[model samples]
Target: MITLINNPVQLKRELLKVVQKELKDEELKVAKSDWHSRRKPIGCGLTIHPGIGCPMQCSYCYIYDMGFSVHATPYSLSGLQLVAALLFNKYFYPTRWGTYLAFGSVTEPFLPNILPKTLEYLKAIVEYLGNPCQVSTKMVINDENVDKLARVGGSKLSILVTVTSLSQYVYLERRAPHPLKRLELVSKLRRKGFKPFIFIRPLLPGLRAEEVDEIVEQAKASGAYGIVVGNLRLSPNIVKRLISEGIDVTKYLRVDLGKLKSGFVDVRVDGDTQTLIRERALSKGLIFLRRACCANTVSQLLSGYNDVACPSLCFLNEKVCEKSCPSQCKVKAGGEPKQFNFHEVIREVLGFDEYEVEVEGHTMYIKLKKPLRDEKSASFALSYLFRRRIRFIYE
Candidate 1:
């Protein structure tokens, strides 16, 4: 029997029927939160964690403070599995959207023990998905892995190497590679035709103007394509750790000590200080990236992918890009209310290659040439298309 849905109310009526039927045959388990959703903060659509924790243990690292893991441990999918998960993820629409997949959000991708497998996973991602990817790391990049990394990044990979202060690397980074070694790796990657950017994160709050100038100059000399500067972000646990270690980062940031026990605080680098760094970067002929764009925008722009989902470094702060005011943003669904394209929405959300939308009298009808995966998916598609809670007519 073929049932036709006449109006939006009819669609809404069948919503829960489809949902209950969809779940009837499946054994429900507590859903594991997908790591794919972690990409919004840094403007990428997908984030792959090669491991659960980082051995580097940089003092300001939020992952450590959050108790995920202080040492690196493998927690990633095989390359092919990662490709499948990405392709099937509802948020990904490779045909019409430019999405970036970032490696190393919760863990370091190229940590010593996991480097070989990480490289293999990178190769697989490039070979299979070919999506734009980025890798942010503090580990030493060996001479051997440079070409492979470049190949994996394809035209869209941006490798951001973190080097805050060479003089303080020993104390700050602890187990990570020496600052010079990491800088040398950046130079090599640049020489090999890969886009390498410098991340002077947490910008080591009390450095002199000359010290900042020296770091930027060195990065430029190393063939860095751009420079990303960030200020120290602190959590209550992290603040305690710093204090216990006899490091006082408070004077370098605009912080209210009274708020210390309350919750996490952003010990922001002041506007004047940030501007000074930005000016220095521009003066040295490097692009000064602000917020969480984190030098990824440079590559994205050069490659003509301007649809950054969330244009700030919200990821680093354990937050997602809110995507507020998504006016001209194509990657985000549901744009200007007047410019609604229902067919496009159906194609994107339902994974339909072919469909026809017909109008009869006052009602719009969608005909699916092929059956959807399930009734629930039809309702899901409807909700996304209307940019609100709606259902679908399932036959």
Candidate 2:
């Protein structure tokens, strides 16, 4: 082993040989369970990862643990394979109401090498599925691909531009474009008539009230249609990375070192700060969102909602009841709401083995590993299972 390490050229050759072999061994396939109850303010239904790992290497990104950090092994689906997988899925919705496709969840959809393929994949979705799609990226946008994206996305394309921090961009997003440049790109997309939303994700825990306001104002000034703020979801590896970069993880957020679960070090910002952020956005006339995804924001932007409060209406608004808001607003409890027995009925009818159900008052957020074979069938099953009229968001 020592000799192999000493001979750098030989080591490189051997590693290349193994990597090529693994790539060849990989099979053409798509994700089986595309639906998820993710933490982002984007819908987690029918997520597509055109490529397997992200080269950007954001220190805090969860994809590091989701099978993308291993430099030796690369994974991705080909255009033909992606189209085939999507077409073969029986659970996909035929119309826009039931089907909202999201891209770039696990991998950067516009990585330099994979950008062309990503465009191809989007075009295929347009031709075959015709489902509304959403994408968030930190890559530098160019005229060539931007035009292609417009063609593929058409009127149903929702864009999320993630800018965690203008100050911390150098440290956190080492490989991605500058935060200000990303804002410029957002403005450009807005000029193109795309509904681009700003995502201040992993909202560095201890951000000052003024700092939050600044981000909101800047995004709004940049022509962002809406803004979504998210807290950092930290894992042990992520914490270690931050620490190595001299980031005071504790100062940014609270970390329960003893309560680590699923390889993640639990860290979260206080609710008061999040509330303050929302208030600031509302005061600035910007569309603020809480725990909602890009799809929800786009729905609110395109089709106005009723029965929603002035400040909170623009945020946390869902396009249910024929793209209308709910009759009344109800507060939801945090930290994964409990699932009731009605979920069992959904499971039995939809044939889902793995699922999560979050019930907030009368509203139920159900996340299925695999999409339902038929949206109407699932709705019918829910209607049959529960006599009460429960608002449900199927992810």
Candidate 3:
């Protein structure tokens, strides 16, 4: 069972100590070395990888640049150990309103070899942490797998079925399941009381925009609650692979492709294309989301977890927060922010008691006597828990 503590600082420390005491040395070692034990970026929460590598070598995948193998392997940590690692993480907060846990970032979480580990991790997260969990997949999930997932995550787990290109699936995602079959999985998920969303991620240039209407219409027909559109990011290797697959790479390139050696280059889709998707989605009465966190937040609200607004505070940005969104975040934000012991939270997170906190509207300004050791992680946890923008002033 999960307990709610009014003081987030104490809650985090107590949870960490309890989890650490229960873990074995081997578990602790695995927990310590895992990358999930670090603070993720502002919009993206901690990415939980159920496995390493992906057998479905999509042409646009960038995992190869990150040193992941083409062959898949389940993550080494067991469910309990994975939970312990998350608790040990300085940035992680546990509960329905806590840190967002996203899977299928680096590898396909629902693959046959890795599905067991994925389910184990999901069960443990739902049982112990109760954080908002989400999984994205291109694989066609069977009835048995769907039932298992429903039993474990239920409404708390947001499902994102990736369908990048219908006509070009053979060239782009050759090994993955067909787009139509994946849509069928969406229908099944909806029938089982899950609000699945069609994930049109990496909106491939010259490919995805053409089929926007058909994709949105099919998604709505398949009983998807909404559509999430993501922009494409191209790494050098990804560009090479796409070119080799007989896909055009000229229009997406602003600079010479050869000049880019390391890191990813963002390819912004045309505004008209984005407008088209948003309009189509809204016409179908389907919620259109630009960020994954928005979908996660909506799923939690619809699941009856809590009425709390988005932890990322996306409601402040109109572009990302859809007017058609059923979440009452904007209205909730208009009300008074949740009260927290800011002084204590600061002391617990920063490991010092020499800071002064000032609150104005929805933002908290912390005047620090000295510099923090890990400002990013501390700010992320505090801001997420309190749903306030944290600004540290060095005096």
Q: What is the full ranking by lDDT, best candidate first?
A: 3, 1, 2
Which model scores highest in lDDT?
3
Question: Using alpha carbons, what is the TM-score of model 3?
Answer: 0.91
Per-residue lDDT of candidate 3, residues 162-211 (tens digit): 99888888999999999999999999999898889999888766655558
What is candidate 3's CA lDDT for residue 349? Answer: 80
Model 2: lowest-lDDT 10 consecutive positions: 306-315
Candidates 1 and 2 compared: the better one by lDDT is 1
List the candidate numbers ranked by TM-score, top first.
Answer: 3, 1, 2
Query: Residue by residue across 1-395, what tens digits does model 2's lDDT show?
Result: 11242222233234334433343333322332232212212234467666667767887788877666533222355544454444334444322322456677677777777677778777766654445567778876787777888887764477788888777778888888888888898888877778787887777765677777778888889998767665577877787887787676766565776555566552446477777876777777776654334334344346343211211122233422112223233332222222234444455556666777665544456666666667664653343223122334545
In angstroms, the error of model 1 at 10 is 25
Ten residues in sequence with the least summed lDDT for candidate 1: 24-33
lDDT of 1 by residue, 1-395 (tens): 01322222222234323433433222111111344422232344367776788777877777865668776777555554544444434444221122456777678888877776677767766654444567888887667777667666564577788888766666678888887788898888877777788887776566678877788888889888777766576887776666665567765566676786666665556566666777887888776664334355456555565543322223223222222212222233223322245565566555765766544422345566667776565554354334333334334
| Steric clash count of candidate 1 | 2
Alpha-carbon TM-score of each model against the true structure: 0.68, 0.66, 0.91
Best candidate, TM-score-wise? 3
Point out the higher-scoring one by lDDT: 1 or 3: 3
List clashing residue pairs in candidate 1. 292-312, 292-313
